[model samples]
Target chain A: MKRIALLGMPNTGKSTLFNRISGASARVGNWPGITVDLMSAKILMGGHIAELIDLPGIYDLHGFSDDEQVVRHFLANNALDLVIILLNSAQIDRQLSLVLQIKKLNLPCVLALNMSDEAKRAGITIDAHSLEQALQMPVIEISAKYGDGLPKALQAASNILNQVQQKPSPNTIRQLLEEDNQIEHEMERLIQQHVQIPTSLSNNATDTLDKILLHKWLGLPLFFLAMFLLFQFIFTAGKPLQDGLAWALDWLRTDVLEIAFASTPAWFHGLMLDGIYNGIATVAAFVPIIVLFFLVMAIVEDSGYLSRAAFLMDALMAKMGLDGRGFVMMLMGFGCNVPALMGTRVMRSRAMRLLTMLVIPFSLCSARLQVFIFMIAALFTAQQAPLILFGLYLISFITMFMTALLFQRQYKSVEPFILELPPYRLPTAKQILLRGWLEVKHFLNRATKFIVIGVVLVWLMTNFPSNVAPASAGTYAGQVGLLFAPILDPIGINQELAIALIFGFVAKEIVVGALAVIYGMQGDALMAQMATQIDWVQAISFMLFTLIYTPCLSTIATLNSESKSSAFMWLSIAWSLGLAWLVSFVFYQSARMLGF
Target chain B: MQLLSQLESGQSGIILAIEAEESLFHRLSALGFRVGKPLSLIRRANFNGPLHVRLGSTDIVLRIADAMRIQVNTR
Candidate 1:
């Protein structure tokens, strides 16, 4: 099987092409690393088993952005036999620059001129033959959306690897055009013969849609409308499934527990039924919402609207010392902080990326989202759950913005910003589901391994001091709790809550799992633990700390890889920990001062 | 020049410069909002403040002051 690496800037239809060839969304995201996440997919191209390594979206080989470096290093290593560069023909100039750079690498490459349907619709036409002749390489024109020219493109790629004969020289043009003016002249000539840019592609459908969707007065309304629909889709899609699963989990916990452990000792019964099954059930409860969220996010991402979102958010983003590109990383942070931090590689300046990485820990990932919702449901009513959950998100976002401002004042490095703005296209449903499932799978893997281990460890810590009778304070668990109690005192978290929260910090959903294991909560496991052990003020403090706390281990590793330095890696870890400590301290102290 | 929200869609204009009173001048320019680029107003945000405008195929959202500073002549 030949290995082909698909390369392109974000939103140039690489994912679209990959999806068409492989019958997969390949992964979620049209922008940057969201789709491939720096991994290769095993694909069969042309009835032959071939591995497709979908590299992250990168603008150039010259830059040092994290994913760029990943691609640069990968390409330079010459690990693959074929390279397919997808370009948006409509934005030919900007995308062509990348092609020009990729061409200079002197690799076996195929350039797929994508989005030709839109280009034609916009009155633009590309001469694929001219582009091919100009570069002395094969150029395939395809529209990944309309499924036009995909077979030809893939076949070209396969043929090039198989039956096609390469010229003896393969024609490496080092001084290809001789001068900048000559190069421009040649490019202009090629476009003049083969490409035509439309004067206007305006249509009443889009114009009418834009009137309401892109309305100045109504734009924001529409933006919120889009956002609300996304959230509604997530909630409505998952709520019933979540309820049925919860009912099944309840049966597993009680009826199944009684039958399975009827002959076991009390301690063993508690360990197997409450500790193990409880952890499993806790993870299962939120699985629906997490999967649903990822699905909607994948849809938004694959639709190419996420890039426009970055554009729409540039003003607010710039205010916080980030460019539109930084928002790309932030959106990734919504899935998990680790990738978001890793996504910061797109940021040019080390300082900006570092600062953004520091604050990203504040954004709630899907893992933590379930914890907040569970607590809200348990403490208040179910109706209040959504509002409080929404408030927490707002608080995290505002805090992240303010924190960015503060960090920028303390550092002075400028990031050279160049971005690719992709036109909106509907993402395929198959792709969204596939990408969302990968995320769901990753979360489940964590839940099974680290989360389960974390719960048991916390349970062991809190259960060891069973001195008085039914696990009293003299046990090892109580002793450890007493030991950590003072360390947590100033921060407003009790030792037990702190232990649980720390375990949760590994992956936020595990907090409930740990608490359930510790306190033996039923039904609404997370909320039950929070209410029984943590007061309202402490709960709020815990949530704030959770928002500002150290990123999960996966994020830590990703940050380390991005920074490529132990020092910078630890700096983020230390900064987030210190910030979480301070934020929680203030919340706890201020609340006490105000007689809460 | 009016804020981006005030401009009709598809209208083209040139950015004279950024008029931000705050510290957004350099940031905006770094993001390619420098003077002399032909910018088109796309959409505006809440209260005609933050505006979505395009420069060189890259759409950017900027505040009213940033938009106002980039003097534009409607075509």
Candidate 2:
């Protein structure tokens, strides 16, 4: 078996290429010393399997960041048979430094200059043969997104394995003096001799787009409008599909659920209808909207436009000690904070990485959207759902920004956002749609595991009158909530409802699942009644607090794993809890004073 | 004149010395940015955009003041 690792600086289409070769069969497991998992994919190159390891994007092996260390270890440990370096053609200078570092490892290597298609469009030209000779290695230029020349690149690696060539040079420290100067001088000479970098493209089409998109005077406004449109699409255009899913779930409850319980005893019947059936139904409502939102995000990221987004927003981030990497994580945060927090591996500075992780929990994840939309939809017409949803997102963005300012004030230093903005390509439809489907499938599977258990437990709580609570307290559900009513009184939520939301701490979706058990009889009426029990301040407080709270246990585990710092993990939990409490307390108290 | 980050985004400018000043443009220069090149600040995000710039045929996002430090002529 050949162990091959693909390494690159950020935005060289490394991950996209990995997806192409590995499909979705990659095994994701955490590596020691890093917060995120080291992802490996098995491609049967010749009946003998070749394991392709996708390391996080790293600029230099010397950096202290989690990603740099992983790549550094793999090289020093002789972890892989060979290393394949992906270089961004347009930004070859910055990328070549890493290639030089790897070459110093004495490993048999292949250079795949990805995004040649973009290179061509950008008016840059390279002499492939001369370039290969100058670097004293095999190099193939290909666009991972468009699938151009990828085969030949893979073929080169295959040739090395087929030859059983001289064992690759084991990476060790002899401290070669000429390494940096040699590559830089050679790359410059090579570019001078072969590559023709266009001095015009940036001023042409991209400039026109950036002029409107990144306008100093108009940039923020345009960015906001674009973001507004995206959010609107999630709630407005997404509603019909959401309602359709809800309708089908309701049908299942009335039709199949009732049929399954026809002759069953009271408790079994309750478990089936209110427990299992209800859990499935609540999860089902999100399938449509979540799929829509992720699909859009994937398409944007795949096409390389997200870099432009990072471009448009890089300045203000530096003020807070964040970089383009933090921006990218924040984008991913919109999908889910766990992965975004994990994705912070791209940020090399520990202090910046920690701050980014701390702030991400405050960004709204999609799971929270379902609850926000459903409740707000109940309070107003469907037209109002989008407006209200936008308001929540607005609140989230504002809160995140404010929190970051506070974080920045208490900080020392942060790494600059060093990002390569690749030329834009039309994202591959097959890949984008497939990735979106895979995410939805993953979420649904998790729903099956935890949601089913929580639903059944909540049903039993409501069913048992002579159960855990005092016998005179009626059902176990009411009695349990009664014991904790005073604790939630400040938020203005009654005991029963407050108890259910507290259950959400385990997983946000369970809040809806538990509420389903409590309010199944009322169906649509539950929203109205839920409102009466909690005033506007309390409801908004709930939304804000939940937004700022610790991400589910899964993210906490990822936080612990990725940063390799238990302190960062515990601090995330503690600080978020503290911030949420302070913010919600102010909101709740101030609202009552204003008499709403 | 030394800090690229001082330049506001959306300003079309010229690149000055990088890396020598420990600026993000220097990092980009290490990434592939060169001296004596035209640079422009595209747009900056509240927190995520490290630094957005338009140079030559490609767009680059660097840490802070990368473009700001590069002396440029803005019309």
- Which structure among the candidates has the greatest lDDT? 2
TM-score of chain A of each: 0.51, 0.52
Backbone clash numbers for all candidates listed:
10, 30
Give the TM-score comparing model 1 with the true structure, all chains together.
Answer: 0.50
lDDT of 2 at A447: 43
lDDT of 2 by residue, A72-183 (tens): 6555544467778898898775578888877776778899999877778765797878989988788998889988898898888887767666664433322332354467
Root-mean-square deviation of candidate 1: 18.5
Query: Which segments of candidate 1 are over 4 A away from where they belong?
Result: A1-211, A240-291, A324-357, A364-395, A409-418, A437-456, A463-472, A475-477, A506-573, A590-596, B1-75
Candidate 2 chain A least-lDDT 10 residues: A169-178
DockQ, model 2, C-alpha based: 0.38
How does the DockQ of candidate 1 come out?
A: 0.16
lDDT of 2: 0.68
Pull out the clashing pairs in model 1. A338-A555, A461-A477, A464-A475, A464-A476, A465-A474, A465-A475, A465-A476, A466-A472, A466-A475, B19-B69
